[model samples]
Target: MKHLTILVPDAQTSLNTFACIIGAYDIFTRANQHWVGQGKDPVFTVCLAGVSENAVIQQDIMSIRPEFRLSQVAGTNLILIPAISLDFERPEGGNIELTGWIREQYNKGAEVASMCSGGLMLASTGLLDGKSCSIHWNAVDKLKNLFPRVLVKTERLITDAEGIYTNGGGYSFLNLVLYLVEKYYNRETAIYCSKIYQIEIDRQNQSAFTIFTGQKAHGDEVIRKAQAFIEDHFREKISVQDLSTRFAVGRRNFDRRFIKATGNTPVEYVQRVKVESAKKSLESTRKTISEVMYEVGYADVKAFREVFRRITGMSPLEYKNKYNKEGADLAAMS
Candidate 1:
């Protein structure tokens, strides 16, 4: 039997944390039972482990008693960390002790998987350094700022580097668990579990759900002014050279500063601003795709569609259909 450890973090309560722990336990147990029904022994020995005996989630909210404490855990085949909290308050003594144990367990040949914001915890162990990880889009900027060594991929739903696995945001951790089931058990069992749980199988992208907001938290005055200019004039064809000249900075220096301050090149920032504005227009107005394209300074249909898809993971029409209120009302009438 493969030993699986589901870690219950000792921190403030989160719905994802509770749901992930129970969901993982329930699914794995059911999967093992499926094998038992097939005239075979159970395949997994799952344990809920934590640093404390009973983790107090919140005041009078809920408390969970882990099956095993960190000290009681001998050797685990796989370790799963659920999403803890978006605003993590590093415990009184810090999570150094917990992270140390995680590192030691990995060094002893156990694989690790982090779900959603749990990637933040897993990255704390330093295992995700020099590795690509998929974190929730909401936390991507914070993760990048906090852990510069970790490569945060916003578009990917799942990232598997060696034995370390990280998944995208929200309750989509179910998909990650299904993916692990396929790896540990078999394709047939994974499919069966997926059907039983009503989870869509083989989902690979979370880009469709991401909201693109240009990062503007840097202290660069000139770059901030440039960002404001782009936002205000996104409907026009604003050139990078013009921005550099207006700011009295060289083109190359301007590009470098823009990238450093905003994590996007001047051209990319302008395109994002335009696309974001176009998104608003698509959702609120009944403007035709061509009209919206023209409003965003894109005269060519092909160029507009390509850039819209590249940034929003959907074509102009698809985005409109998905988010437009008028489209929804019309569909309801139909």
Candidate 2:
């Protein structure tokens, strides 16, 4: 039997999708565990994750006989997130801690995935960047608005961008868990698991943008070079011909596989990184808009401003104004 753990601010708290995974995964003949009263007994855990329950459960976990720390996290094979904190508008506090642990597990070969807004936490950690990822539609605006580096998309169930898969909401969690079971055990096991959970397995065809087979192979020499090019010249004008020549593939072939795997055309993806870098510059430096534009490889202020507004829905000046105001508030407190 496989192990699945759900993390939560409180065990008493309930988020819809997280709770559903627990009930859904059990049908795969897998045992499960949850963090309760602030104590996660890693000794008996196979998975580690959060819950979608109410804060009362969170209070219960906080009041655990001992205390909660990521002790059992090492034993976790899979991680599941029910939903995210409602009170915390962004992925902060315990949520960040949880994402960090998942990242740790992912590095060590453990499978990590999430449902609904949980993708925000996964994405925020840079875990889902350079990969296919998705989140709830309502939350997508804020996600793209903030994380320009990630290829955020819309999906009804799960988008498996490489190994990091995310769903649209809680009910989608059931599909993901069942899919996970199918991956490890067998299609039959997933069927039995779904049967036990009384969940549907036949989801309609989803976008090519959502699911990924997994990250590029462990040691793909070609992809490594492409990655380097993307980092060094992302802000510059990079053509598919440029990338294809390096990979020794024709431009057409290169574009298809790159988009199929990365969820964006070469230009769209690089622009995303440049936009992200611009955001950082806007937040941290006092460079004028023109300097910032050239710094990010765009010489035309009008063009850059238009693209920035289109993606983030705000002028660069507006972004700086908002960012500066927040910084000022923090400085005054200090």
Candidate 3:
């Protein structure tokens, strides 16, 4: 049997982490049971490994038991790190032991997968340096700020490179586990699990659900002003040159500061702001796609559609149909 070690963080406690740990274990164990029901042998031997023997959470209201500690396990075929506490600013304290074990496992040819913010812990191992990862969209900026070498993408729901894998926000870990189910077991088995769990299979991107709130916590005063200007005048044709002139900063320096502070270039930031505004209008108002696009300062049909799809992974109409109540009702009828 292939060994699957699900690594639970010792001190970290959160509902998402709890769900991921139990969710992963349930799916893997159920996959084995499904195999046995089909008169076939089990494929995986799953273990819950952690730094401590037990972890208490929710003010000691709940506790988790682990099957093995770091020192007890020699090696394993795979490591699944669940989401941890959202305290992204948690200083590098005693967790060197956990991150070090993760790196050592990867070096020994074990594949590692992190769920949601679990990517933060995996990133501590320096294994994510020069690698692409997907984390919760809300935490993308923070993760990028903390680990500059890691390429964090909010568009994708899952990312897999080398021996490392990651997923986007919340309970999307279910989709990632389903992906592994297809990889290790078979497409049919994964479909079976999908049916049983009521999870939509083959979801590749989280962009459709994104709500863009530009990063404003950076200390760059000029860039913050530029961002505010962009938000205020998104309905107008506000160019970068216009912003530079209005802010009395050099064009090149302004661009550098904007990107550094917001993780998006001036033009990209403007487009995102406009799209975000358009999203709100589409959701709450009965504006047609053209009206929404025009209100957001885009006159060209093709240009608006391209930018919307690039950032959101869907056309304006698709987004509207998904989010707007009337559109959803129409879709349900047809």
Q: Which candidate leads the pack in lDDT?
A: 3
- At residue 140, candidate 2 shows an lDDT of 60
Write model 2 residue lDDT over 1-334, tens digit each, in one string.
3455555543212445335444544543341222122243322234333422222233322321112346544556666665664333445545556667778878876666777677766776778777766675555655665576777665445677556767766466677777776676557656765676687885632331232222333354565567568877877777778899978988887777766555557776676667767877887887777888999999888889887765555688877776766655665688
TM-score, each model?
A: 0.91, 0.49, 0.95
Pairs with steric clashes in candidate 3: none
Q: Which stretch of 10 consecutive residues in model 1 shows the poorest summed lDDT?
A: 88-97
- What is the per-residue lDDT of model 1 for residues 56-76, given as tens digits with 9 covering 90 to 100? 454356666787788899899
Off by over 4 Å in 1: 89-94, 324-334
Tens-digit lDDT string for candidate 3 (1-334): 7899997677665878888989999999998899889999898899988776654334345657788887888989889998888885652433557788999989999999999999998888899999999999878987998899999887999998997889997999999999998888999999999999999999999987888989998999888888888888899999899899999999999899899999899999999999999889888888899999999999999999999999989999989988899878877898
Query: Candidate 1 vs. truth: CA RMSD?
Result: 2.3
Estimate the Cα RMSD of every predicted model relative to the unseen true structure.
Answer: 2.3, 16.2, 1.7
Deviation of model 3 at 310, angstroms: 0.7
Ranking by lDDT: 3, 1, 2
As for model 3, its CA RMSD to the true structure in angstroms is 1.7
In model 2, which regions exceed 4 Å deviation?
A: 1-3, 10-14, 17-21, 28-68, 86-89, 204-334
Residue pairs with backbone atoms closer than 3 Å in model 1 (clashes): none
Q: In model 2, what lDDT does residue 306 have?
A: 85
- Candidate lDDT values, in order: 0.86, 0.60, 0.88
